[model samples]
Target: MKIDVKVPAVGESVTEATIGSWNKKNGEFVKRNEVLLLLETDKASVEVVAENDGVLAIQVEAGQVVKIGATVGILDTEGKASAVSSEAPKTAPVTASQPTQAPVTSSPASAHLSPAVQRIVTENNLNPSQIAGTGKDGRLTKGDVLAASTAAVAPTPAAAPAKTEAKSKAAPAPAIFAASGKLSKQGEKKIVPMTTIRKKIAERLVEAQNTAAILTTFNEIDMTKVNEIRNKYKDKFKEKYGISLGMMGIFTKAAVEALKAFPAVNAYISGAGAGTEIEYHNYYNIGIAVSTEKGLMVPVIKDADQMSLAEIEMAIRDYALKARDGKIGVDDLTGGTFSITNGGVFGSLMSTPILNPPQSAILGMHKVEDRAVVINGKIEVRPMMYVALSYDHRIIDGKESVSFLVKIKEGVEDPERLLFGV
Candidate 1:
């Protein structure tokens, strides 16, 4: 019996997806529920799996636009997987007179590798034997290959001086302008079609610029107390929860409190003209903007207002790992009432975050630095972080935007306020 492999519906807003790389090829035998290919939609990447053990017959090639329910391939259940050799691969016999040598054959790790992992190995020219596999049953994962590649190819500091000395002895070359090279270079004249996710991002950003009155309000928070609290309990917190305490959880909680005080910031506009009215969300589903390889994805933490600090930390960590592994689902990316994006990890001191449409506002978090500030009658240095609230001016006024930011400032500055709801 043959079963058709169709693209499953990702979400209501998504009508179609671009076919990403296929994990298995035509005539390749795959087990039931094995990932066959990846579907790239605007919201998230969905992994399409085989229905049963079968030989795959690919119909639609990758990079092709495919609609939901469209058949991309066929699976013949009657086909069987080839048997593995029970004995280890034989090596050529060596005499005592010849120096002992290691076999040049490919590592057995290739059999256990996924399609993504195989691609990384081939592109980087990495030796699998030198890399210690941390995956199940000593199998190599994509992360393992990447880490090995980085370590293997990284230049040593001692070689830098000698290379510079050799360069100094060489004749100087003529300087070329960037535009001159860009226009004249034939090898660089290449183009690739945009992924579905990238296209959607472009469309939405333009729509936002055309449709909404976006404004950003900024404020700074003294992190002395928050840092003190973390320092006082980090070990205990990690021991109890099995995850480190981080600034995001505190910021997420603070944002939740601030949103409760300002209802308009949490409301979304529906309809047009007189029929238009603000739909206030009583529950908070906070979106944490996670940067993925394809594009930026906001995976909502549902009912964030109801979650504990530890729970929020766990959820944030989970989404981050999912993003790293390219496993975030469309369902994980929807229904967010508000969003928070931290550019601090990338050393961004400050940036205005754009709003996620239908949501009234987004909070931007920046890197913390020690700065001198006057406290009461004395000037002292303290750790401070800048925060920005970018909101729709149509729904949220300047006063509400500024005040909402102040609320977050207070909650973070005084950690007790967030814990006790003062």
Candidate 2:
């Protein structure tokens, strides 16, 4: 019995994916639920698993574009394996008289070779068994085949020219030598095609720039009190929760309080004129902007205001790791009322964060630096961080935006306010 293995739908709006790599080779036995291939889509990379135990008969090649539900391979069921094995072609044993010459017929399975390897094999008319594989589990890699082809076609010593006369008339050894030092180094510039997430980010940034009256309000917070709390309880918190307590947890709590106090900043502009007053959300789903190798992805922690500090820290850590590994789901990256981005992690001093679309505002956190400040009319060194709030000016006035930032500053400076909800 032949079992068809098709590509499963990864997520909504994701219709196609490229075969990243195959974990198993054609004709190899695979177990049920074993990962067979890696599928790369616009948003994530997922493992394609075998549905049943059988020998894999791959129909598509790695790097080939396949649509959702497309057949990638066929599985030979238990009872049919013996029959399939019997049908395989019998080869004449190698001998001096036979010369071990290449066969005339090529297996249909050859059509499933990766493009890079396929091109080299077809151009050289090489047999699959002739070259040794070096990829995972001894599968033929692109580099392996290319190297094999190069060795086979290399010029022999007998074909070299015996002797040659130096030409005295050769044009003055061209002035090209003088320009060698001025040439640009290798890979000085590169133009890579944008990935799906990057393209989406570009579109969103442009939309935000064009649609909203964007404005940024800045304020600085003294980290003295916040650091004191963390230094006092970080060890206990980590031991109890199995996770480190970070500034994000403290900041998230402060942001939630500020959002509650300035309801208008948390609100979105739904309609125009009489129909549009302001739609305020009672719950806060804060978007935490995470930087990944592919690009920036914002995964929301739903109802963050209701979560404890430890819960918020764990959720952020989980989402960040998932986003970096390209395992975050569509639902994880959507639906947020506000966003927080920390450029300080990358050593940035300050930046005006762009708002995630539909969300009225975004908070930017910058690196902390020790600075002399007036304390009781006396100058003293204090750890301070500059915070910037970028908001839609149309919805939030300058006063409200400034006040909202000041509220966050106060809450962070005196974290006790977070406990009492002052």
Q: What is the TM-score of each candidate against the true structure?
A: 0.78, 0.72
Q: What global local distance difference test value does model 2 have?
A: 0.78
Tens-digit per-residue lDDT, 1-422, candidate 1: 98999999989988898877667656678898899987888888889998889988778866779999999888989976443211112323556533343322345554555535654554454556666788877778778897877776555676678768876887353243253333334343435577688888898888777777899999999999999999999999999999999999999999999999999999998888532788998999999998865678889999998999999999999998787667889889888999999999899999988889888899999999999999998999999899999999999999999999999999999888887887
Q: Which ranges in model 1 have alpha carbons more than 4 Å from their true place? A: 80-187, 272-275
The CA lDDT of each predicted structure is 0.82, 0.78
Could you list the CA RMSD of all candidates, in the order they appear? 8.9, 9.3
- Where model 2 places Cα greater than 4 Å from the true spot, the runs are 1-3, 18-23, 58-66, 78-183, 186-190, 270-279
TM for candidate 1 is: 0.78
lDDT by residue (217-282, candidate 2, tens digit) is: 899999999888889999999999998889998899999999999988888877764235678899
Candidate 2 weakest lDDT stretch, 10 residues: 83-92
Q: Report residue 178 deviation for candidate 1 (angstroms).
A: 14
The number of the candidate with the highest lDDT is 1
